[model samples]
Target: MNKNLYIFKNKKRYRVNVRNYNQEDFEDLIDLQRKAFPPPFPPDLLWNHEQLTSHITRFSDGALCIEVDGQIAGSITSLRTNYANESHTWEQITSDGYITNHEDDGEVLYIVDICIDPDYRGLGLGKELMRAKYETVVYLGVKKLAGGSRMPGYKKVRDKLTIEAYYEKVVKGELDDPVVTFLMKSGRMPERLMKNYLEDEDSADCAVLMIWKNPFIT
Candidate 1:
């Protein structure tokens, strides 16, 4: 695949290339993931060296990284699955191991994870990465993008609202939720709220099940 370069002017002009992940990026990607996610999720939750290697080996194009000034600042890992009529849990999708559930002929692109370095936030890198995901969907002729959106803002108000209520507020624009807000703005609609989605304290043990259909699919 050819490398895709995205240039934008935020605080200042910058260039980033969204490309396939390479074996050499293993260590940097691991380090970036650590800084991107906050507490309650154990170290094991972060992909280790072996897991990273396994994913790249299984489906190279499914894993992508963003490079800024030649350094990896972000990444998005995904897998293809046939989920049209199936109900899945976070554990089941990610359970077989790191991207172990990847199916080459599947029609749905399941985004397993995404992370941007702290210093690179607010520069529109996340949006660019998401755009790249859509490009991948079109390239592979997939039907949709599906994944769990971590509710980083939930922890702050969990005591005051139920997960469902919180999601409703975010959807209704009554509250500013970090992950959900970004997902919504990126065209992903929330389908439901998932409990124990992952071990993140910020999300308060829940995730917003979101999906974005590929307009070019049908």
Candidate 2:
């Protein structure tokens, strides 16, 4: 795979390249994930080097890393799954975080995880990564992209509103939940609300099912 498949420029004019993950990137990617999603979740929920290696070994192009100034700044891991009309929880799609659920002939590109280093936030790298994923969809000839959006802001209002209510507010622009807001702006439509999606405190044990149809696919 070409290491320079995708490239972007941050506001500060730094070059950021999205490329296939290499074995050397394991530790750095682990560190980035730690910083991007700190505690509150069990250690088992967090991916380790071995698990990531398994993913890359199974499907090489399914994982990507972002390089900025010669360092790994962010990474996104995805898998291909058969197109299903119904919604899927994170555990169901990813097989309880094992990530062995990937299928090469699947019809949909499932975005398992995308993380940007905290220091790299606000530089539009996340959006650039999303674009890279769309390119992956086209490369894999998938019909669409699907994933569960973590509601990082849900815990704040979990007491006052139900998960469905909060999802409606976020979709209607009545709330500013970061993850959901980004997905909406990126053209991903909400499909349903997933209960106990993951072990994240920020999401309040819920996630919003999101889908982005590929215009180029048919």
Candidate 3:
């Protein structure tokens, strides 16, 4: 892993830092989940101390955090694995987010978690965190960046539109899904939609399978 750190200044002039997350960041990271995922999303799904430790212990480079003025504002967690079974659910692939399935030499960098603090929106931190993930693909010599993005905004439109219609509109920018739209802007292309991909009720338990191929594939 390159251990490269990315820095910038947001509109408010707060220094933003994108770098690897350590055990000391567990508190901020956990609080971030409370703000990012809240109610309907299972609280159990949030990163626990054990899980945070597992991330760094198993693959430190796969865990990155974005800080603003030294305050953790965003996080992205990934694992290395091949996309053999498209039918696999989030729990199966990530061992319920513990990332126990981490494969050192897997072909793809599978992002299981990406969230920005609700207070930190409009800062482009999500995109920057994604850039770090893309960088991980290159630095770790992986094949691509892949993940099943949530559609938190789907629930709001479910009554007015079908799932397909919702997805289509989001892709066309006629509509916006919190996670899906953000990932799209970060250069991830939606490949397909899968049911029961996650336990997220906000997304109607559906997920958009997305990916970004590495241009410099070795």
lDDT score for residue 111 of model 2: 83
Q: What is the lDDT of residue 113 in candidate 1?
A: 87
- lDDT string for model 3 (1-218, tens) is 32334344453466778888998899989999999888878988988999999999998988899888778899999999986337879998888888888998899899889988999888788888888888788877778988888888989988999888898899999998888988888899998888888888888888888998898974
Candidates in order, TM-scores: namely: 0.93, 0.91, 0.92
The lDDT of each candidate is: 0.82, 0.81, 0.85
User: Which candidate would rank higher by TM-score, 1 or 2?
Assistant: 1
Q: List the residue pairs that clash in candidate 2.
A: none
What is the C-alpha lDDT profile of model 1 across 1-218, one tens digit per residue? Answer: 44656566654666678888888898899899899875666677887888788778888877888888788989988888886335566768865447777889988888888899998888778888888888888889989988988888988898999888988899899998988899889878888888877777777778888888899767
Order of candidate numbers by lDDT, starting with the best:
3, 1, 2
- Residue 112 deviation, candidate 2, in Å? 0.9
Model 2 misplacement above 4 A: 1-11
Residue pairs in steric clash, candidate 3?
A: none
Which regions in candidate 3 have their CA more than 4 angstroms from the true location? 1-11
State which candidate has the highest lDDT: 3
TM-score between candidate 1 and the true structure = 0.93
Task: Write out the backbone clash pairs for model 1.
Answer: none
TM-score of 2: 0.91
